[model samples]
Target: MSQRSYRTAIVGTGAIATAHARAVRAATDRADLVAAVDIDVDRARAFAETWGVPRSFASLSELLLEEKVDVVHICTPPQQHAGLAIECLAAGVTAVVEKPPTLSLAELDELVAAESRSTAHMATIFQHRFGSGAVRLRRMAAEGELGRPLLATCDTQWYRDEAYFAVPWRGKWENEGGGPTMGHGIHQFDLLLSVLGPWEEVTAVAARRARPTETEDVSMALVTFESGVVASVVNSVVSPRETSVLRFDYENATVELEHLYGYTDKNWTVTPAPGHDGLVDRWAADTVSVPSGHDAQLAAVYDALDAGEAPPVTLAETRRTMEFVAALYASAFTGERVRCGQIGADSPFAKRMDGTGTPWGKVTAQ
Candidate 1:
């Protein structure tokens, strides 16, 4: 709110907290890193020292009460996101929280309610949406270059060893929500819903082949979009090589995105269909392409903030994503097809998981 740049505070000092620190430091004149916080004082001090931040706090209340923070980057895990973000909003500090914004739809709904009652600018940190390929795909879809998207597919394959789950909250349902689907696959899931619009229904099944958790290690779903497009989502934490890809089949041609950190070409292959030469010609004539990524989206955030407009990834947009995950979980639990936009605040799935222990421990090593 000051011309002196947006004073910022990062509320968690884990690995992601460091990345947010770098992002804050990397932000242009639009934002500044003012402080860092963690429940662990030493960790907070280490992050503050590393980032050259002048302030450190053991809790959000201390930072809110002491720091002149305009924005808060919530780098905590999913279960911790809702409360901190609500506090930040109530403190009149804008917030950019990490993805899978909350552990359940109910938590997310409460967050939305809190944000609605506040004037703070709130957004989810879906950095993948800021990536170049994602931006391009969204633009094409908007311009109708991808006409009446008929089919969509997402494949996310990443490995997570036993040690990766050693963290106290890593594999538990109450803390982490679900395994790959809710934790790792969340970004891709958000991107998919963003580019493809809303899903009409989802039928999913999950497996625990790799990790020891009540949550699934591998999962796949058939998503039917409201536009009559059918999509498949494949998420796993035990693939040999990491790969995240999205493919869309439209009336005129096919569009694909390779979701890597620094994607260069962001290839969009346009092949004229049997009788759709005119559509191909139109795309060839009007389509303008460029290299894009998280930087592009981040720039958009700064611009929106400067212009006093809402951030592109608003709470409303993210709520649908939470619903998507909620539906997937509901479908998995009830063994029935789950419809989107139907889970209510009083839904049984609203409650947190048992958080007892990792489900992968149940099976002996092969």
Candidate 2:
């Protein structure tokens, strides 16, 4: 639908930046990778050359000043997402930011406020939500075909060794926000939130268990959704057996998705309850195969842009996911139930993921 291909630019030349470039290449009919930017000019130049992009710059300011880039992908660290997104919003350019979108609820609120003042938009990369399986499940839930959702479970169990955190910005609260709950688990859980509408409350507990980091290495939560659904959530980076799993049990069927990083239609399975075996045929009617990845989400983003509207995973929607993150952290730290919209601007949790301070004291070898 986009008559003119969007001249897109990527601002970070890190590991995840390649996925963004590949996504741009995947949507060649809708977008063009016109420029690359990084703090390391040589790295940016090499990335642009490798990706066949036209230009490279040492910083976003230089790229913004020189190129008419329509969309900028912020693939930098968690602390940098808000600033870069705000700059893009102010410059009248659309920004697609990698998660966790910001370091705190306050920063996300800032980006949301900035978007209200700009014509351009801010979108977060929750790619798993765009896959065919998730879409079908959400449609069924919406149409009341899945029956009353009763129970659910979401888990993001992945391994991250000490060497992985030695990169200077991997585990610190000031850098990556929280541990797996903020960085790694947010992907699958955001997909869960996408299907389950709004959450009512969270009661969580986190521990420093293994990692010698400033934040918790593992977290567990009990979440209650507004739809009368109760779900248990777990996030960890210390598990030897790495797996990302989600299971939804409705009155008529049980739907499950099992994958490590990404999922295809093949990774999803549906089991009908007694006397509801007919629903299997209905679920089988959807045969589309959109895998969970940046390409699929970016394709959808371009479609929204083409339709003269803000992109998918926009600020309004991201706020809900982020507030969930905040609530989980608040409940984990304070030993009390945290509800939706409870952590306002006055709350310390709004300022940082660890709030005023963490129970772990300092980053000592534990």
Per-candidate TM-scores read: 0.89, 0.98
Please give me the total number of clashing residue pairs in predicted model 2: 0
TM-score, predicted candidate 2 vs. hidden true structure: 0.98
Cα lDDT computed for each candidate against the true fold: 0.76, 0.92
Best by lDDT: 2
lDDT digits (tens) for residues 164-273 of candidate 1? 88888887777888788888887777888988887899998777886766678888899999889999998898997888777888887777767543354434455655
Which portions of model 1 show Cα errors greater than 4 Å?
1-4, 260-262, 266-294, 353-366
Compose the digit string of candidate 2's lDDT tens values, residues 1-366. 536699999999999999999999988778889999999889999998999988999889999999998999999888889999999999999999999999998999898899999999999999999999999999999999989999999999999999998999888999998899999999988999999999999999989889878889999999999999999999999999999999999999999999999999889899999999988899889878899999999988888888989999988889899899999989988999999989999999999989867777643425
RMSD of each: 3.6, 1.5
Q: Which one wins on TM-score?
A: 2
Clashes of each: 11, 0
Give the distance in Å from residue 30's predicted Cα in candidate 2 to where it truly belongs.
Answer: 1.1
